[model samples]
Target: MAILPEPVTLSLICILVMMCVKILMDQTKKNKYHFPPGPRPLPLIGNMHILDIKRQDYTFMELAKTYGTFFTFHFGRAKAVVLIGYEANQEALVKANYDFGDRAPMPIADDFQKNHGVIFSNGETWKITRRFTLSILRDLGMGKRPIEERIINELQYLNALIGSHNGKPFNEKVFYNATPNITFSILFGRRFDYDNPNYKKMIGIIDDVVKLTGQPEAKYYNVFPIIKYFFKTPGLVVKRVNELNEVLHEMFKEAQEAKTEDSFRTYSEAFLQKQEREKATETTEKIFTEKNLLASTFDLMVGGTETTSSTLKWAILLMMKYPDVQKKVHDEIENVIGLERPPKWEDHKVLPYCLAVMHEVQRFGNILQYLPHSTPTDVSFRGYTIPKGTIVVPLFSSVLYDETKWEDPRGFNPNHFLDANGKFLKRDEFFAFSKGRRVCAGETLARMELFMFFTGMLQKFSFTPPPGVKKEDLDLTADPFFIMRPKRYYVIATPTI
Candidate 1:
């Protein structure tokens, strides 16, 4: 009698109807969507169990061997398409372009950037911020004149910082500060003294927060939206991000006070002027607010700092690990610029070996290993239909280490960028900065800084492992995280002078 009551009868009927609808939708998807080939996914957890959680790049490599170049997989219930090898990536992300131009949603990246910057934003918002950013950066000499002078000037401070050690062993702390200060000065219009309490705290917080992102535990939150909402795993990331924001906010406040209406001193003032202009136009919903400015500023700061610094850090570690390579690079630089003065951005013309070494560092460093893109709409890529919003990882590892692309994909070989006559040869397969509309906006600036700072250090000193540590035993293995950074170790920077 209770079961037959009106409420109980209605509940039973509703449940049955909903179940039929779900079954029908599942069947429809099966019949309609022609997803790429891959191993079958299980319910709920999906393909996460099969993945090598710690090193995703390595996992992706192994998966390519099984599923071939383009394969569909899942992180929990969400579908992901992995584009492996040079051709597969170039076709989908490069030639087809805008179809796969959207940024794949990642909770951790959203939280880190607060979803207001160019890296994670889409549509008109992203377009406005990107265009504004490029304009301001160029005006401030980002890839050009005054910027190169700023970098070359910064190298003096960096070289002095290294020389302070008096050939004693030092960790990455000094290198970290030296690299970021160049971008930091450009973004805020002033250089931070390396020992400034606020500066130390900011770098330390970012370094730690970056470590948390690419870890297996935190990456789940990025892939599966459910985990991010239900769990407390992002608390540390949130806290550190807040700390970084506070620091950036203070910088903006300082910049605002210093700026005249007509004179834009830094990235902050240019952005503020845009916000004012947009407000005057009655387009108050524009992305030119302080939040977007800071997000874009933070994007430049974090990205500019991390990639160039990490690559150089890896360069030091690689040179130390392979001393013979170091000697040749040292000898080449000696031949070109000599030890009396430092290396400039323009020195690349003569420093072929040194230039090749930098390229190889980027290639082998593979700092941003797993580059994620997304399909904005249904994209028929290479005879496979990828549904809208599917995550596409253009495996940078595959491009950086493709057997067909590199003569010896496994080793750290600067000769990879060199011809038989020892001329610098640029390889198209080197997708360290990625490709397409999403290619690194700060690329020109990064390249200039990497060449200058790297040669700057090498010109003044030869980096080698600490005494009693054999070059054979020195660990060049990267400390796996959001970026591939050299593991913490001391190196003796013996001055070439």
Candidate 2:
């Protein structure tokens, strides 16, 4: 064998020495800290070897039973706190919001975000962008009439599309893409035809990104980027994110070129106005820049599109499973508003059962079951210390499924939102829209859209499994994805009216 160069041999020896020392120091620190109770971690790999990446929540669920409400889990070399139960989560997320008020750094998410926008950003970036976004939802109309009316109007198109389905089984695509088409019109001041290929492609890309980024392989890539060459996911994800951002930028440019003075036709215009105002200030660290706007707009569009669609899927699924509830909703709509007119947002108060069904859908759906929240500063909570930048996952599923909080947390029961008198009741455990300062900014828009779409569907067609299929045969568990999306099933939308 040939002898290696002296410099190369020396460098390799030095690197090996450093890595050994680093591992030893990490082991020492792990021993020194008063970390929450959990399983012992192996050397170098930490607890990754024991973690069930495909079903992390299940693993967490089992370990929590052993370790109690508060515990720690290691993701490769990194460790994070898992907060279970309503009190543990509420105290950390709401009562001590600022202490746990940052977004965790994921290599994939960071690559897509580049530290821009509200959803994936923290500190001043999040604060300013969120303020700007909330302003659009609060002040004036998204365009023309009020946001609720806009949603109600768009319901006609979805209603027509499903009507065309002729009661056959249709995938979530129509239901999923409907909200995005409406929001895109609101954002870009234009609408895509139902068969518009570009719009379809964009929506499909976002769907893939959402699901792929949440997979166990994603964690592996984050922990080991060198594995990227061996696997295709990282590269493909990056390409798709670029494609999405490029499309958003183009749409924004088109909107900006067509100047309008009539009170902000689209969200893009409103965001541009903010960007211009901030740009004229000429100060560094001005959060309202083009990249931020693009990221924010993209974030809003993706979020606005995906969430309600997922919730509505669960809604229809539940309705099909419980024909009694579906009939009750139809009866409630006919009694309260009648088939002459669609369900309006104001009619929500009187249609208590309808509203209850909607709430139960969201609460039980709990699509955002797993989330990563970060501590921007060293957080000392409940006699434990969580260092700055530590990733904390406040289990929304825990709150939604807490037996102490819900009468029947596991079942698909709408009575959870109804009282003895059959009136709608609100529960504090309903954190489906999330809670605290970091709650979903699009809560208003999402709620209106869901209420209208859900009621509208039930009003036009009664949902059920295909002929000869029983409710018990339907699967309740979601497809393994970022969102708790229900598995593929056939639904017949028989004309109820």
- What TM-score does each of the candidates earn? 0.93, 0.90
The Cα error of candidate 1 at residue 455, in Å, is 1.0
Give the per-residue lDDT of model 1 (tens digit) for 1-497: 35565998889999999999999999987776687888788898889888877678888888889999889888888889998889888887689889989988878878756568878888888988888878877888877778888888888988888889998988876778776887787778878888888878877877887788767668888767667666665777878877888888898888878877787978888888777778889664778877787678777877888878888888888888888888998888888778877677778888999899999989888887775788888888767777788888888888889988899888999999999998999888889899988989989999998888888888888898888988888776777788888788888888887
Cα lDDT tens digits, model 2, 381-445, are: 87887778788878888888887889888887889999999988888888887778779888877
Highest-scoring model, lDDT = 1
Give RMSD (Å) of candidate 2 vs. truth: 5.8
lDDT scores of the candidates, listed in order: 0.83, 0.80
Off by over 4 Å in 1: 1-30, 112-114, 229-232
lDDT value, residue 24 of candidate 2: 100
How far does residue 118 in candidate 1 sit from its true spot (Å)? Answer: 1.6
